[model samples]
Target: MIATRDAYGEALAKLGEENDNIVVLDADLSGSTKTSLFAKKFPERFFNMGIAEANMIGTAAGLAAAGKIPFASTFAIFAVGRAWEQVRQSVAYPKANVKIVATHSGITVGEDGGSHQSVEDIAIMRAVPNMTVIVPADGIETALAVKAAADFKGPVYVRLGRNKVPTIFDDTYKFEIGKGVMLRPGTDITFIGTGLMTAQALVAADLLQAEGISARVIHIATIKPLDEEIILAAARETGAIVTAEEHSIIGGLGGAVSELLSEKCPTKLKRVGIKDRFGLSGKGDELLKYFGLLPENLVEAAKEILAEK
Candidate 1:
């Protein structure tokens, strides 16, 4: 198992070798955010902006204006919450080629409590006009996402977690900005998931298979600019939908899928995520299970949705 933030740091370091225009910026959490690895590799190109997230974001914007591909790293709460106005006014407004890779997002930043955790980051980022929002499933997907974000020209927000997670993708996996990948094929019901919840969805599929139920599993890596075509196809085929994410159901992955289906397909759907509540401090796995984001919870949701169908 590997943490996505670990893959992010390694990917940024490798990208530095390939592109000379690439630079890294961090607020005070380089060690936790793992951007310190890049700083070690390229001291000249790394900028430690201290504990000032707003300043760090503005500095990244300036670097983008100077034709540098700046990657800003920090905790999700500070990156989005503390410096939201700066990010909105500076980088995203200009459509800068700045990558904001935030680690320890959602309820997985265990033991940090609700104040440090960020459940609204994805929602706010998706609301921005020119920003691209992505939440990779695992370390392998995180590497691919970092590389893809670098090549794409725009403001990108990549959300990663702190704990090590099961690898869902291999070396052959290809990640597109606004495309969903189907991991398993089924006709009874469809499970659309993002982040670590995608792994749980796969597990739920296995459990359902034992009960003679065919469940289709689709991983949505890109939250904003969602793959509506793929989702609509799934709704047309499966007839029922269940969305899982390591975020609140209000305005995250669940909300995005709900909006899409309501406008286009209008199918029976169930969302598996935090029920618009704040996360408490605990172990990552425990918090996930407590919030009903486990495979068993997904199985129950699928069965309930299937019964309605």
Candidate 2:
């Protein structure tokens, strides 16, 4: 089973045990956010803010100012939208050591539907000057990103999927903020994705491989302050690009890549994601399939994109 929730939980638990400076705060969502591990291990350092996301961000900012590495937990919407002002003024402006750990992000929140979905979180968070935005592909990387965020000095928004996802990379792979991982290399076309879409991109690559199409898949783990070198290289290597994501195509991974590639290589690109619409209540996979973000969807987009060559 592919699951990043437990990975984040275990990572926070380890951080709390090893670093005295680490503090965890949740919007009374300890169980759902998987922050119960930190609360259980370090009860004194854990704060259950009782659904006040703005207060949680403010408190986390305060904790950071006091030399504590605070990780505030909430649904992605609350973290970016509800607490946006505090994040901008208190954390990003001052460059505080506050980590906003948002679980249940994107349409992956499933039955929660349009209300809980965080489709615009990336566009919103990425606009912050000092904010570092990260969307790990799976459980293992989420764990690593958690540790890496602890090392970062300023504000961070670590966007995580709600469900279990395949562990595509082993421990041998190293992770660093502002760096993207290039998985499959191809000269024909490039498939770039982040979070759950990366897994789908891997599957799409396998399918495309069988059809005599070479597709390079890259995981954009760090969204904001994107690795332009890797992106521009992909555009230079492959003439066309296909970007998939569990977010709106307007301002998420696709928009970011397009913005970079436009100024650089100016390649042919197509984005597969929520097409300017909110999601409905259903199973996660159902919503993903409905939004055309599945492997099959990427395969079709890839084939259509490569046909231009």
> Which candidate gets the maximum lDDT versus the true structure?
1
| lDDT for position 174 in model 2 | 92
lDDT of 1 by residue, 49-109 (tens): 9999999999999999999999999999899999998889999998988999999999999
In model 2, state the lDDT of residue 73: 91
Root-mean-square deviation (CA) per prediction: 0.7, 0.9
Q: Model 1 lDDT vs. the true structure?
A: 0.94
Q: Determine which window of 10 residues in candidate 2 has minimal summed lDDT.
A: 1-10
lDDT of 2 by residue, 179-240 (tens): 99999888789999999889899999999999888899999999988999999999998888
In model 2, the runs with Cα more than 4 Å from the true position are none
